[model samples]
Target: MRRLMSIVAILAVCGVIVSSVSLQHHYATSKTEYCDLGETFNCDIVNRSEYSSILGIPVALIGMLGYAAVAGLATVYRERRDTPALLLGGALAGFAFALYLTYIEGRVLGAWCILCLSSLALITSITPLSFVVWVRSRD
Candidate 1:
């Protein structure tokens, strides 16, 4: 359980870091610039999204902060897997947010960034792993 949680946590944190860096790259090039890398690896839509920023902060930034908090919480209860209610809650929250962002990218944005999708995958993985960890803790 510890190893699984650690792996999940690492993946999720890497997702957050990558997303944040990508957003920062977009923000830097938002004006008269597009981080284009041919087709199927577009970051242009992410840069153009109206919802990409909230109160002057990038959405990716929010994701970074959120994932960081979740990681810390997971670590706090790392030894108490039997009562991992908080960790489960964190996983649920992360998974929901990731899925929502993925939907936004596919349906609303109409462009896909590999980094964002990877983040979504990480969150998705976390949800199931956390559940399994919680169950193992009980056993």
Candidate 2:
């Protein structure tokens, strides 16, 4: 369990970093060369779009908080029996939101953010690993 939680914590930290970059992009007044691909793959376009926020709050900020919660649960609360369930539940919710954002990028926005894709990958891995940890804890 410690090993699994360690991995989860590491991945969550990476997610935080990715989300921080996205948040920066969300507020950036100028285009960044690194994430500025062509039209179909422009981070600036996707990050600045109307869908980038919810109820006037930046989605990237929400993502940072979510990842931080997962990391905290994996590390600070790992000793608790309920931590596994909590990790699984949080992973599922993050995964679902990531999927929704992905759909918005591909379908509605017609643009993609590399940092967003990286975040999606991180959450995707975290979800399955969290499930495995939950299953093992159940046994």
Candidate 3:
């Protein structure tokens, strides 16, 4: 269980880093070479879009907070029996939100941000790992 939690913590940290990069992209004024991968996959278009923020707060910031919460649960609260459930629940919620953003990028924005996709992958991986941890803890 400890090893599994450690893995979750590491994945969450990666998520934070990815979200930080996306947040930076969200605020950048000028385009960068790495952010633009032609018209189909442009981080600038997705990051600068009106959908990037919610209630004046950047979504990337929310991702950072969410990942931090997961990390904290996996580390500080690992001894607690309820930590498994908490971690699983948090990962599930994060994954769902990431899916919604992916929908927006594909249907509304028509552009995909690599950072956002990276975050999604991180969260997707975390969700199943968390579920496995939770199940193992139950036995």
Scored by TM-score, the top model is 2
lDDT of 2 by residue, 10-43 (tens): 9999999999999998999998989987998999
Candidate 1 regions with alpha-carbon error over 4 angstroms: 30-35, 38-40, 80-83
Which ranges in model 2 have alpha carbons more than 4 Å from their true place?
A: none
lDDT of 3 by residue, 18-114 (tens): 9999998888888977869998899999999999999999999999999999999999999998999999999999999999999999999999889
Clashes in predicted model 3: 0
- Candidate order by TM-score, decreasing, is 2, 3, 1
How many clashes in each candidate? 0, 0, 0
* TM-scores of all predicted structures: 0.80, 0.98, 0.97
Residue 96 lDDT (model 1): 87
The CA lDDT at 58 in model 1 is 79
For 1-139, candidate 1 gives per-residue lDDT tens digits of 6687787678667867877776676567453234456544577666557867779887788778777766765666577634366677777887887788777877887787776777777778778887887777776
